[model samples]
Target: MFYRLMKMIVAPMLKIFFRPWVEGMENIPAEGPAIIASNHLSFSDSFFLPALMKRRVTFIAKSEYFTGTGVKGKLTAAFFKGVGQLPVDRSGVRGAGEAAISSGIEVIKRGELFGVYPEGTRSPDGKLYRGKVGGVARIALATGAPVIPVAMIDTEKLQPPGQVKPNFGVRPGIRIGAPLDFSRYHGMENDRFILRSVTDEVMYEIMRLSGQEYVDIYATAAKRQIQEAKKQAKQSGAEKQP
Candidate 1:
């Protein structure tokens, strides 16, 4: 019920507003378990890709958006919830990854679509970074669901970083790639080599679609450090407020 309602309401509004140009949409099965792996560029990339396709695509979003106090926060939370986003706390380093994979696997097990940004977070410099490969590969191997690579072009520009509002006229494109079946890798549950191979294949598809340079190393940890710094600064400010 929630998925259908979102598909009908928010999806159309998004399609109209963005005037999205989509390609290779046929890659997605009309109804089945699949994972949409996309590059992260902007926050809006989440809302845009899901709206471009008629089928409900579930992305594991940061828990903050789904938990809030004000009306604005509540509305944002409700919208994402309606569109099939499950919140996972990304605050901690160890547990968040496991939680994300578990939630995504549950969605796939229920025979629904799940979306993941293998790069983990938005690219700071618009380059495709090496994927973590843990969550996506594990879920696909577990559920036997085909992984579909999705790429977004100009989404970062559509809704520029940190700007709450998007510029009305920019057109965004979504490129979908063929479904990947790792049946050959079947039964290698404990094999690390097999998992990395399949995850690389999925990311390769994303690179082909987005035409972005791929990095062998993962995204920089500088952003996380900056976040920690900000929190510490805030705490210091509160303590000094005598």
Candidate 2:
């Protein structure tokens, strides 16, 4: 009841505010357990597409979102909650993957539509990065759900990293690809590799719709780690030089 009311209220408001141009919404199942896979671009990306969708789509949000308290924090929590998101803590170095997979599988088992970003995190460079097979395909294979590839363009431009509000003029939009069926590969008997390949195929479709540059390297939390190491080494060498 709350989910339905949320869909009713939020969808129209988003359309008016974002003026989003939607495509291929027909690809989404009017009824069934399905997964919508896409590349992550911005914080607003989650809210944007779900507003365009007719069905109630749920995504996994970081647990911090639910824990925070304040004006902005409560508003943020309310927005996510209204949009059918459940908190999944993907914060630590370990156990995060297991936790996510378990939560996702449970969501699917209830015959709900699930949303996942295959690229794992937002593109720092606006280029589609390699996907970590982690738990997306695992849940799909486990639940026998079809994966729908969606591409959101200009979303990053709407709310680039630090700003509190969207820039408000860029007309955000989405291009959805056809639903991918992995029925042929079903029941492969715990074949993780095959599941990854299936994940890649779904990502390939998203790349086509999004038209973003592709990077084969995995998205790592080590970006700052590597940069800081290089900086320290350079400073040390300079001090020794004279």
Candidate 3:
């Protein structure tokens, strides 16, 4: 109910202000369960994708989005809830992967579109990163749903990682690729090698559609290295100031 209301208000606003362009939307199944795997470029990717889609796309958000304190936190929680996002524990909790897999399986079994970022986290430097296969592959194989590769173009520029507000008037593009059938790997959900192959195939399609340079490292690992480099640079600068 809240999701629909917010969409009614937010979708038109996005269409008019951002003027988002969508291609291959017909590729999204009009009904039934399917996984919508896409490249995560910006926080705005969440807002833009669901706002533009006719069918609801449910993504798993970190628990902090709902557990924060204060009025700001409350508002944030309400917004995400209304946007149809589910909260999951990403704080190194044991069985976190299993929890996510179960949540995804439940959603797909209910015959709804399940949105996932196989890259695991948003790209740190605009290049497509290697995908994390744990949950994505399990859900797809567990439920036998087709995985559709989606490319969210120019979303990073609309609202880059650290920015507070979106750059209005910038139209991001969405390209929905055809459904990827993994029936050949069906019933092999427990096989790690098969999971990696399927995930890589999905990522390849996203890279092709979005036209982003591909990086073979996991995004989270890359983010850590980048953060460490920045910290060292800052320390060097501080020492020079003395």
Q: What is candidate 3's local distance difference test score? A: 0.90
The estimated TM-scores of all candidates read 0.86, 0.88, 0.94
What would the per-residue lDDT of candidate 3 be over residues 128-209, giving only the tens digit for each residue?
A: 9999977778788888899999999999999999997889867899999999998778788999999999999999999999
Check candidate 2 and list the clashing pairs. none
Put the candidates in lDDT order, highest first: 3, 1, 2
The residue pairs in collision within model 3 are none
Can you write out model 2's per-residue Cα lDDT over 62-157, one digit (the tens) per residue?
888877798978877877888778787776846777777777878788887888888777777678888877666887787788889999989989
RMSD to the true structure for each prediction, in A, is: 5.0, 3.0, 1.6
**Sort order, TM-score high to low:** 3, 2, 1
Worst 10 residues of 2 by lDDT: 218-227
Clashes of each: 0, 0, 0
Candidate 3: worst-modelled 10 consecutive residues by lDDT? 91-100
Winning model by TM-score:
3
- What lDDT score belongs to each candidate, Candidate 1 first? 0.83, 0.81, 0.90
81-192 per-residue lDDT for model 1 (tens digits) = 8887888887795799889988998899888999999988888667788888687888888788888998999887877777778877788889888898876666664578
TM-score of 1: 0.86
Quickly count the clashes in candidate 2. 0
Per-residue error for 204 in candidate 3, Å, reads: 0.3
Candidate 2 Cα outliers beyond 4 Å, as residue runs: 1-5, 225-242
